[model samples]
Target: MSTPVQLYIYDLSNGLAGQLSLMLTGRQIDGIWHTSIVVFGKEIFYGQGIMITQPGKSHHGSPLRIVDMGETAIDEDTFNEYLSAMREQYTADKYHPLEFNCNSFTNDCMGFLTGGSIPPYVTSLPSDFLSTSFGQALQPQIDALFTGRPPSGAPARITPSAATPDPALAASILQSVTAQATMGGPGPSNGILSMPPAPPVAPAPVPPAPSLPAPDASLVSPMHITTNPASFHNLLSSHRAVVAFFTSATCAPCRMIEPVFGELAKSKSKPDGGVGFAQIDLSVGLGGALAAEYQVHVTPTFLFFLDGSKTHELKGVNAPELRTQVDLLIYEAFPPHAHMSLSLSALEAIPLDPILFSQIPNLDTMFTKLAGFIDGVTAWNGAVTQAQVKQTLTRTVLPFLKASTATSPAQPPMASFDHWPTLTSSLIANLQLSELFPLVDIWRIALLNASFSAWNATKKVQEGPLNRFMDKALQAGDVPRNYLLTVLRMLANAFSNQVLAREVILFTRERVTKLLVDALLHDDVTVKNAAASLGFNIAAYLQKQRIDKVKARDDSQSAEENEEWETEIIVAILNAVERETNSEVTVHRLVACLGLLLRLSPYTAQVTSLLEALDAQRVLKGKLEKGGCREGGVGKKDVRRLILEVADKLCPDMAMAM
Candidate 1:
C-alpha cells in the first residue's frame, strides 16, 4: 500500500560478512551462495529483518511477498522530534556525523514506527538493500546531526570556523586557565573536552653556566707594599707587628729564604687580624741604602717591625730551619695571651733600638740592665771560654740566625770549621782593627789549612769583640797570600766606606799580582784556576773604577810609581787570561783585563804586547764572531766600537789599527 519500502544492506569486506552469516544462520559459514544479491557464504546479517508473506498470485516462479501495517506514514513534527531524540543520545555518547546505509536507517525508522518492535518483512530484506539510492541522499541528515543542538536541553555545538583565533588573545586565555587550574578552580574554558591538542611547548631558556671560583689567598703568602713608604708607617702604627723582607734576586741566599718568609707571613697571628707582610727588592734599587743601614750584608734577610720600629732581625737563612725560625719570630712579635709574661721578659732583653747600642747583649745582665749590658759588650773584651761562647751565642744570636735559616729550604748544611782561625781572621779584617795585628796574622795563616768545623766553632767570638780588634789584618805581612786575599775579599764587601774598599783593593792588587805570576808557572791546575778567577774579579773591579773615575787622587804617590803599578797589574791580568784553562773564567778575566788595559794604561809597549797575546790566541776575534758581544765580547760591532773608542783615547794614531 505504501510503495513497498525497499531495504538494502552492504558488507564492506567479505570476511566481515561471513562472520555475520554464521551469527544469523546458526551454522558455521562455508563458501556457498543462495541468491545473486544475498550470496549464502558472502551475504551476512544477524537477524536484522524478517520477510512477510501476503495472499497474492505469483507472476513468475515464486509468490510475491508484502509487508503492510496500518498508518505507516509519520507526520513531519513527529519525525523531527524523533530525529532530535536520536541525535541527543548519539551526542551524549560522543558520536560524530557519518553517512548511514538504507537498511540501518529503515530498521531504526521501523523500530520507531512500531514502537521499538521488529516486523516479519525485515527477514525478506536483501543484504544489498542498504546500497540503494535512498542511503546516498542521507549525507545532509548526518551532517546536521552533529551541527545543531539536540533536544532535551542538550548543549549547543562548537563549530570550527575559517577565522583563526588571535594568538595573543588565545595565549592570554590559556595563561588564565593555567593559573585557575593551579589555584584549584574550574578551568577558564572547556577546550580540554573537545579542543584539538596543542603542539608541545619547549621549556624556558636556562640561565648561563656558572663561573669557576677564584683562587684561595690564604694558602700562599701574599706580598704587600704601599706605593708610599708613609703608608707602611701608617699601617704599622695601627698594627702590633708588620713583617718586612729586604731581598735581591742577585743574592743567592735571599732567593732561597723567600718561601720560608712567605710561610711565616701567612701563619703569623695578628691581634686584630691587621698584621701584614711587606717586601722590598734591594737589587731593583728599592732599598739598597736602607738595607746597608740595617747592616744587611747577606740575604735573604728579614726584619720584624713592631709599632713602626724594627724589633728583631732574621738573617742568612738555609732550608731546614726556616719553619721553626718563622714560628719563633711570629711568636715573638705576637705571643699568645698566656705567654705575655715570658714575651715581656724576652722583649726587655732585646734593645728597643739595637743600632743605638755598640755591643750585643749579655745573658746575665740582659734581664736587669739590658741597655747597659749591650753598651758594655761594645767595649768589653774577656778571654771567653768555648762553652761560655756557645752559651752566649745560643741565647743571644741563635733566635735571629734560626729565623733567617728557616726562610730558605734549599740551602746546604752549614759548613763547619774546626777552629776559629778562619772566621776570626775574616772578622778582624771586617772590623778594620789594628790592635789585634799579631793575633790576626797568626790566625790568617792558620785558617788557610784549617778544617771547616774548627772555623765554625770560632764564628761567634770572631763576630764579637775580636771583630773590632784586628782592623789592619789585611796589612799584616805574616798573613798567608791566600788568606790575605780572602780577608781582602771580605773587607771589600762588608764595609760601605770607600776608603776601606780602596785600602782592600791596594792590598789585594799587591798580593794577587805576586800570586798570579807564581801560579802561571805552577803545574797545579786547581791553583792556576783559582789565581785566574781571583785575578778576573780584581781586574774587573779596577776596570769598573777606572771607567767610572771613582778613585781619589793621592799626592804622596808619584806619577811614575802610579804608572808602573798600573802596568804591572795589566801584565799580570794578561798572563792569567792566556794561561787560564777554564773557558768561562778565562773569558771573563780576558774581557775584564782587556777593558782595564784599554782604559787605564797609557804605555804603548804594554798595550802592543797585550794586543799581540790576544791576537795570537785569537780569543777576541773568535768571541766577536761566534758569541756576539752582548755579553762577554760576543757582538763584533760592540767590540769594534769599544776598541775604536779606547784606541782613540790611548793612541789616536793607532785608531785604524784597532
Candidate 2:
C-alpha cells in the first residue's frame, strides 16, 4: 500500500560505471539511458513520453532497482490526468540525450506524483557528467546520434491530445524536485547510481495500460514550472495574473497546500481565464534571484501579479487567503467595465478591443500601406478601389468594435488608447472622400471600443473631413449611400464620447441624426438601413445622457426638457421604422434598433406616439402573431419575443391592451 509508485531505469551503451567518473566533465557526459514512472494500480498506465516499458520488457533487462515514491491520496482519475499532461509537456521531440532525457521524465513525474524526488545520481548524473571534460568532448557525437533517428530505445513522437492540456494546474501527483536529486527518505541514502544495466539478462514484463479517467471539465488544469529560471518571465503573457509559489525543501506547510494551490490554479486559468500559476523550488539552482527579488524569505510564499507586476503577496498555507487574493487578482486582470444600470453583461456587450499590433505579423506593413493610400495625391477610382478599401478597413477595424466601450481594467490595445492620436490624425489629414468612406466604418468601430480621452484625441481632425464629406453629400442630387452610411455610423460611435457627441450634435444644429432619419425615405434600401442604424446609436447615446442627467437631478426644468428631447428622438426613430417597414434591406436592423430604444426607456409619450403615429400595433402585432421577426421563420432565435419584451418594458399599459 505504501509503495504506490515504481521507477524503471534502462542503461544504454554498456555500464555507465566504466567511464562515468574517469571523463566526468563536458563533451564526455552524454550518457545513454532511459527511465519510466509507473503508478501501481489494478492496471499500470504505460508511460512512453519516453517509451514506458516494464522492468525486463525492454532490450535492457530488469531496472537496476525500483524506487517507491510512497502512498498518494490522489484518486485514479486525477493521477491519470497528471500523467496525460506530462505526456504533453515531455514529448519525444523534446528529448535530449545529455540534457532532458528519460531520467528527467522520471524525476519530474515522481516529484509531481508523490512530492518525493528521484535519487540524485539519476536526475543529476547527466548534468554532472555533462559538465565534465569527457562529457564536453563526446557531446557532439552523442547529439548527432540522438537527433537523427531516436535510438531504438527512445519513445516515438506522441500525438498531442485535442483537448488543451492544463499546464498551470496539477492533479493528484505531488512533485518535489531539489537542486540535488536527494529526496529525504529512508531508501537510497547515498545514491542508486548504476552502471549500464547488466547486459540484458532478460526482458522485464510489460505492464497493462491504465483505465484512465475522462478529462477534467475545468477551464484550465494545474501547472508545473520545470523550465529554467531565465525563461520563467516569458511563460506568462501580459494582461494576465500569475501566482508564484516559492517553497523550500524544508517547508511542511508548502507540501500541504500544494494540492490546493494546484486546484485553485485550474479554476483561474480556464478559457477566457486570466490567471497563471508557477511553483518554484528554492533548493534548485538560480532560485535565489527570483526569491531575493520578491524577498521570498518564507516557504509557501504566494506572490500575485497583474500583467507581470507583483500586486499582492500572501505567505504560509492559508488556503482561504490565497483563494481570495487569486480571485481579486483575476478580477484585476479582466475587470468589468464601468456601466450604468443599463450596461450590457459579458455575454451581451460588444467587444471593442483594438486589433493589436503584436497579434498581426504584418501589422506595420498594413499600417504603412493604409497610410500611403490615404496620403496619395491621386483620387481613387470609386468603383475600382472601394471594395479593396472596404476590405482593408474591415480587417483593421472590426477587431476594435464591441457591443460596448470599456473603460477599465485597462489592458492591451483597448487600454492603450494613447497610441490612437497619431494614427487617427494621419487618416484625417490624408484620406480623401473616396477612401475615407470605407475608413469610416472602422473608425466607428474604433469609437465603439475607445475610452472618452482616446476618442477625444482625434475629434478635431475628424471634424474637417466629416464636414467636407457631409457638405459634398448635401450638394448631390443622387446621394452616395456609402457617404450617408459613413456619416450615420460615425455619429453612432461618437456617442461613446459624450462631449464629442454633443459637439457633433451641436455642430450642425443637431442635423446629423435628423439627416440620417430623413434619409430613411431614401430610394436606396441600403441608405435607409444605414439611417436606421445611425438613428439607433445616436438616440441610445443621447437618451442615456438625458437620463443620467435627470438621475443626478441638477434641475427639474432641464429634466423635463430631457424627457421631451428623448421622446422627440424616439418619435423620429419610430417614424423612420414606419416609413422603412417596406424596405427589406434594413427592416431587421431597424426592428433591433427599436428594441434598443425601448431598452433605453425613452419617455412614455414617445412609445405611445410611436404606436399611434405609425399604426405600429397592427404591423407589430401581426409580426408577433406569426411567431418571429424574420420571414419564413428561418431565424435561429426568437427576435419577435425580444422586440415584444423591449416594447412591454417601454409601455406596459399599451402592451397589455394590445
lDDT of each: 0.37, 0.49
Give me candidate 1's TM-score against the actual structure: 0.25
lDDT over C-alpha atoms for residue 166 of model 2: 23
Question: What lDDT does candidate 1 reach at residue 585?
Answer: 36
Please list the residue runs of candidate 2 whose C-alpha ends up more than 4 Å from where it truly belongs after superposition.
1-435, 438-465, 506-509, 519-530, 546-568, 579-592, 595-603, 606-610, 625-630, 633-638, 646-658
Q: At residue 477, what lDDT does model 2 achieve? A: 68
Poorest stretch of ten by lDDT in candidate 1 = 350-359
How many pairs collide in each candidate, listed in order? Answer: 51, 42
Which predicted model would earn the best TM-score? 2
Runs off by more than 4 Å, candidate 1: 1-384, 388-497, 507-509, 516-537, 540-561, 602-658
